[model samples]
Target: MNAQPLLEVRDLHLSVRAPNGNRAPVLRGVDLSLARGQVLGLVGESGGGKTMVGKAILGVLPDGARVERGSILFDGKDVLAMPGSARRMLSGKSMSMILQNPMTALNPVMRIEDQITDVLRLHMRMDKAAARERALEMLDAVQIRDPRRVLRQYPHELSGGMCQRVVIAIAFACNPALIVADEPTTALDVTVQHQVLRLIRDLQMKSQTCVLFVTHDLGVVAKVCDAVSVIFAGRIIESGPVREVFEAPRHRYTRALLEAAPRYDRPETALHPISPALREELTQEIVHTYRIPGHAV
Candidate 1:
């Protein structure tokens, strides 16, 4: 028998309160799985529920959002069924998130040393001295220079790339089993983005951790992900090994997304955006599949 997946999401249907007091579906029966030490990419356009999937797994959905049905299982335990305290205990210790914006992710007023050490202290129960030492080690692991100096500085004192590195360091401080990286490289330039990607991949390999890398960039997925899932209108329409799916996409939407991305080999080629008719078809399909009246697409 195959070993159980590290993470499994099944028939997850979530909704948020709309302005008019109606619930709008955000995740429509979305299902996916991630094995230990694997990097799975969740790629889709804006407002396609990519980030929502990550949020649901982490149990950090917005205030107005609710999981109407389905389950999220981490390490064979039902995360959605766990109590608040149980979920909180699992969060920083076994599962952590690396958000899109490092500036907002890190507390501006706190020193870098305190930020990293706090998680180590809380999760690992390290004493003050031990936490401090481990914090420095975490910084060095992320390729930060002059770790001691950086420890004394605040978020504002570091460059954007450095701040992101610090955030990454914090996320990995507890050696969590799973990480949900939501567009972690979107805020950086090309060179910095590549470096951050490499750093994340290296650290993941060393730790043997699973990652749910959520991004709209196919290029980033191609570089870092072992498997790929294509989500559209809150549904996973296609998924498979990266090489197989990229070379021969079975879904029309998947083909459209691949075509939409820019090619390095053919720099002269113009981009082709997804057409409106396809979007409408997908929207209708979602409505038909769920058969729920007044379900927002």
Candidate 2:
């Protein structure tokens, strides 16, 4: 058994070259480590490179983006240095991702049965009937009541929440040692988000799987993550135990992100936008017209 960290991302510097050949560094030497059975939360605003970090570990960079430096080690081996064949072998059964958009992740043309069976066949070497049973069981495990019908249906037939759950079911069905969930509840209604999150937590505890949860919602991070990292401008400016960060934020960015989230102490108007000049300088964005300057909205 390997006692090494399940996933260790060294000073990872990632960048993208635009069509005009301008280079943009999205992740500036971001470092994170996850041992087996731990959960690490990456929180930040949109375009802050939270998702990019997760994708980098999965070897799925966006168009034009490349990992300029650093190594992602999983179970004591460098993921990038491994052969493509070895990485492919390690993905589904060892590591998997629950993408932010289930509609895009699941195939519209394929039945859910076939979609899951593909994993079983290619990764687990299971026969058709066994894979089919496992796929249905997986649906049930994720709390999809109509497991059989769902297995026979295409992704388009399911609601967005259902589709997201299906994505979770498929990704988590085989108990991969590590799971990278990018906004695991983005598509669900507010009511179902908790259920989905609870499902992830329950499964994580059961499987002792390390999870790197990426989301812009600090509320979600508060509910799930054991440890949290607050990212800004592609840098982890603050990080610590969830309780400590929530109670006593060390970084100004972290404090601002929390103060921006609705709070009982703050008056409702605290969310009003600050002067365009102030925001532009802080976030490099001109569109945040309603956020109060000292805190968040």
Candidate 3:
């Protein structure tokens, strides 16, 4: 309890410029915190403002979306209040992000070696040989069997899973204190998704890094998150320990989301219509959002 939070979003309010140039609030007084080595899952439909919060933390907002109000503190320092130079220095060294799409995060022209080495050079200032060595070591740590081959290959040369592993390698290379993984397993096949999720969990535990895992899948959240925050219509309506929230959901939207999720052992049948109340909530404000321009192939 005495340890300072790795990251906190206090009473955050975000807004986007509409076509008429009026500000429409996208995030409504969000409050979230994560300590070192903790994982907090943010689960909701696509326009619930989960990604907006993550982007605000990263200082990378989509078009017209701005953090109009709030404080984003990281390890007792206010990130949104920091000067540009300090923020740049702190980002790669103390905080890192793994996007959902591997292809978009990686550069097709640059070899994986250069991509990771650039991070090392910018953050750690390692020599050429040392940086390359570190890059290979990270590739191996992320379970890439042929580390040298991966290092030499361009992003387009690798399979989707391999490219995603490369992204994971970059994110973990600096042993960052906080990592925001936004839908990291999206678009992968079921088998690959399980493998990648396991890898992320193992790495998070081993590195003692706090994670803000933003995903739409409740099953994924159940497997990875120690705590759960259910957001709807740009507001966090419910939050608690994952088990508590799952066992006794207090919010109507959370209940509807749980109801819509399929059960494995139960017989397959027509999905019960999600309650009109929740459906209205989801579609009323924002229908959907795409955080990444082009997701992984």
Candidate 4:
């Protein structure tokens, strides 16, 4: 695996504008780096700025959110400094995102074939016929048995797993250098989730694609990520190799999250939530650090 970073986000601070015009901080000095062909997992509670990081990198921050201070570098190019055309060109073709809900991410009106071929047509500049053929090939690569019939089907006609497979096909169609998968399997059942995860891992390894997988599922992170970063309230509290972090978590939140996850072998182990004191201390640390000028957020 390449040691050089394909994507780097340093000291990123983002805020969402409230209805009253107040800028509420969302991501406070978020720092993340993903090397070529690496799988980096961003694990955190809901609303912990995991997805926001992905959105910021993809240059698709939701309305009312803006980056206050930070630098997002992709392949040594400054994403924040890029021209509008260049940024738009780089977004989907080189950096893509697999949203949490495929149903919402994909167009309900478009057929599966059209959806998958669109990326190839737009980015790869392939002719429609060639793009369609390549789309079929990609569908096959994603393990769809009857790619022909499925191509003609609409998103609503397919099962959740199948729809997600189509979404993956679209995401990987352009062979993006970096993929932000925001809980791609969150809506699927356990069996389907395992299959989807395996399929993603297989494709990622085959393409040597760098991926930043955002999820609250530690089990998924353990299975798929090369490195793991634990985020709490918008800050990365612990990060290292997956095995190292999982085997011995250094942060209270990380430890608590691990202990809280369900373990089949330990059926009697009750889930332990993080204590209120620990939460308070973590919040205090964030506040104190941010208050100190020149301190890393």
Candidate with maximal lDDT: 1
The clash count of every prediction, one per candidate, is: 0, 4, 0, 0
- Counting only residues 3 or more apart in sequence or on different chains, how many pairs clash (N, Cα, C under 3 Å) in candidate 3? 0
TM-score of every candidate relative to the true structure? 0.97, 0.88, 0.91, 0.95
Model 3 earns a TM-score of 0.91
Per-residue lDDT for 101-154 in model 4, tens only? 889988999898888888899899999999999999999999999999999999
Q: Of the candidates numbered 3 and 4, which has the greater TM-score value?
A: 4
Ranking by TM-score: 1, 4, 3, 2
Against the reference, the lDDT scores of all candidates come to 0.92, 0.81, 0.84, 0.89
lDDT per residue as tens, model 1, 1-297 = 348999999999999999998898888999999987899999999998999999999989898999988999998999988989999899758999999899999999999999999889999999999999999999999999999999999999999999999999999999999999999999998899999999999999999889999999999999999999999989999989899999999999999999999876678888999999999988898867873455755
Q: What is the lDDT of residue 6 in candidate 1?
A: 95
Clash pairs, model 2 backbone: 260-296, 272-290, 273-290, 273-291
Whole-model lDDT for model 1 versus the true structure?
0.92
For model 3 the local lDDT of residue 179 reads 88
Q: What is the Å distance of residue 64 in model 3 from its true position?
A: 2.1
lDDT of 2: 0.81
Query: Considering summed lDDT, which 10 consecutive residues are worst modelled in model 2?
Result: 286-295
lDDT of 3 at 244: 94
